[model samples]
Target: MDSLYLLLPVSVLLVLALIGVFAWAVNAGQFDDLDREGWRVLEGGEEAPTATKAQQAGVPLDPGQL
Candidate 1:
């Protein structure tokens, strides 16, 4: 059928476009840190290294209070 001639080329073009996008993603480092994120979740995630008592109290730390 004549429709097949149109549909076939359109389908091929779509497949090629998808492949191009996937290749671009690979070259752009989209998949580079795949495992690090998974491992990070298992590591209990990051937390600030320290917080002062005044910070927790929502008050500016006054040296006199210490």
Candidate 2:
């Protein structure tokens, strides 16, 4: 009976804390782009930019050409 008094309030507080966090997240737009993130993972990642002329011509960009 004594443990019940302690445990019940703790459990209720925990539930309320979780609900508060969820409400804050919703208000902060955390879930606004739900679909965009999922689709981004499905699509291929961005490609690297192409190399410059010096790189393609095999010319050393620094002092050492060979």
Candidate 3:
């Protein structure tokens, strides 16, 4: 019962803190370019040019394999 009191307040505070930070980020236009980021991933625009070249060259990379 004593631990419940401590844990509840801590959990509520953590959730409220996350909500506050998310609200601040939304107010600061952090979500403005959300669609562009997702679209870039689908369009493969986020890939490195050198990686594409290496793929075309048939030269296998060690850790940067496409």
Number of clashing pairs per prediction, in order: 0, 0, 0
- Candidate 3 per-residue lDDT, tens place, 4-62, comes to 99999999999999999999999999988879988877888564666467678997788
Q: Model 2, which residues run further than 4 Å from truth?
A: 48-66
Model 1: CA > 4 A from native:
48-66
Model 3 residue 58 distance off true place after TM-score fit, in angstroms: 17
1-66: candidate 1 lDDT, tens digit per residue: 999999999999999999999999999999988899888779884776777776988988778877
lDDT of 2 by residue, 1-66 (tens): 999999999999999999999999999999988799889889857996888898999977886654
Predicted structure 2: lDDT: 0.91
Where does candidate 3 have its weakest 10-residue lDDT segment?
45-54
Better of 1 and 2 by TM-score: 2
Task: Report the Cα lDDT for candidate 1.
Answer: 0.90
Could you arrange the candidates by TM-score from highest to lowest? 2, 1, 3
TM-score between model 3 and native: 0.54
Span of ten consecutive residues with least summed lDDT in model 2: 57-66
Steric clash pairs (candidate 1)? none
